[model samples]
Target: MGASFEQRPQPWVTNISIDDIHSRDFLAISKIHGRWGGFETLEKWVCGAYAGYTAVCLRDSEGKLWVGESRHDNEQGAGATEVQYSNGDNAIFVLFLSLRGEDVIAVLPWDEWWEFELNKDDSNPHIALLPLHPDMRAKFNETAAWKYAQSMNGKPYGYHNMLFSWIGTINANYPPLLDAHVVASVMTVCNQMQPAYAANMWNEALNKRLGTEVPSYSICNCLAWDLPDLIVKTEMRGSSFAELLTIPEQDDWVYSDGRSASCVAFVLEIYKAARLFDPISRSIQVTEFTIKDAYSLRFFENNSSRLPKWCNDGDDVEFLFCQIRGRYRMELPGYNTMDPYPHMNEMCPSLPPKYSRPSNCLKAFPMM
Candidate 1:
């Protein structure tokens, strides 16, 4: 039987202007909720809960607004650079490579970017989130934020470590039709298609976990095996694929000859550099964050009075932020309630056979 998908309602918008977003200075965070296309739908079904695209909006000293994000252009494939809006003049260059292929990191004018994002799709909803701390604006390190952004300006999007963010457990984290076996099967196929790409993405990560330098010849030989045979061979080596996969060290991870950061990871790394998560979330790896985890952090502004005038705070809005677009009401189920779980992703496979997660770890969203 085939699965039927529900068509979500159209998104609603307010008269909110770019000025309102600029008012928050370098602290405004923009997010789009709901699927825009096949890729985003797959993302929601696989890793994400509710949110789609996320970026940091910064207003520099000269009052110029900018948007920093890690994005992929489907048409470009491995050579993809520059996200061109329907309006040709509004294009942003792709500065770095992404592990998945040629995805790039881009920083572009906020007015142009924001307008493009709002009008990109009528089906998706958007929101602008601000920091909750009253003194965040006064204490924010604009220089450091800009410096960190520039440092990662042309780095690859963290595609190699993307799965680690969602697969906290061997089976629980997987959605319908997905499991460790399916993942291994996919990896086997990928290995057959591009040995080098598979080596860089999986072999290297597995090597790090095994703590032994497995030569290229050995890895290639192992990759040539069938799915069941590969698993059996992996067991013979004394480790499961789940155990061999580890959480990536965000600041230290190097792939495709450069550093990598996914869209959410890119945003959180900027936050970490700015010291926004100081003292409490300092030990948390920014790379481990999913869109749901990033938005749930307590750093966002919750006071209704401080939000923009156009923000609809009527009884319908569940979270602190205003719904600037989309037909359905936006909700962040675990907002500000997540307690940092040290190496939570790494402990997933170690859990009891049927247990989904440890009691102390944050709960994942239900499958949609």
Candidate 2:
């Protein structure tokens, strides 16, 4: 029994103002159907479907990267400010948010995010905000588009939800309706950028290119190749492989079938059912689904009868084969959650860790 997307909660909409970092040092590196952090790892697999940069571009034991922009009062001894990019040898400290194209870059000043109210507005401020829809952009800021953002006079960055679809900090009390108008306007460059094409098309494209079974997010990336090519890669939470591994509509990871460790069988089914091509890399990046839950993988027919009794009965054996298949397929990393403003509190870490440190590793960790 499948319910419709409408049955789900209504999608939250907000207003935002994004500015571009037109500098020579950093090029906007957008991944159209590619892996996260410029690498593939087990954690990348568990944390799949990254539609944002935070989940994809990691520190890799790195303390920080250089923010490009500099504040007027930036002193030499000032701490490493996470900015869009560092200004001149003049020593104006800035930070880099994520690396895009060969030279293009995206950045946010260190203080803007921390200075805002109760949300990511105060946390990761470097998120380049954008007006949510074409309609909102016209009514609020005139066709000026980010004029207010580009001309901020050292004030707390404020966003009207009507103008942008992004919610950084919300009004403690619902704000008053400022005003509105209708304009029969033609669309502009900022107007059209979306992951077009059906999911099936995404699947077909990746499967054809990689010569292997293309995951759902991969399908999205393949579609992205034609659409907006500037967005950071997605987060793993965008699509939950665990959600798929878990039975339909049930939060519980346990399967009703007699036994659950069916990793090898499922992997084989994936190979048979999916369109896989690259034998060398054998890569496929999945979401926040970890190897810890890897054991829960199950199949109806007997596939691992030759395995020992305990491993077979318990839902852990499937992980062993999944590890092999992961290496075999060369699965790449993907993104998880996309809410520029991530709410960690509401979201308790719900899924089990099938592999080592689902937050970090892409390939399953060696069974300790």
Give the alpha-carbon lDDT of every model. Answer: 0.55, 0.20
Distance from true position, residue 279, model 1, in Å?
Answer: 2.3
> What does the lDDT read for residue 168 in candidate 2?
12
lDDT of 2 by residue, 277-353 (tens): 12311232211122212212121112344322322122222411111100011121221112111111111122213
Q: Which segments of candidate 1 are over 4 A away from where they belong?
A: 1-11, 22-36, 72-102, 120-132, 135-139, 196-201, 212-237, 246-250, 280-282, 313-319, 339-359, 362-368
What would the TM-score be for candidate 1 when compared with the true structure? 0.72
For candidate 1, lDDT tens digit of each residue in 222-319? 43333344456567876677544433444565554466677878887777777666664545677766676666666666676786775663434344
User: TM-scores, in order shown?
Assistant: 0.72, 0.18
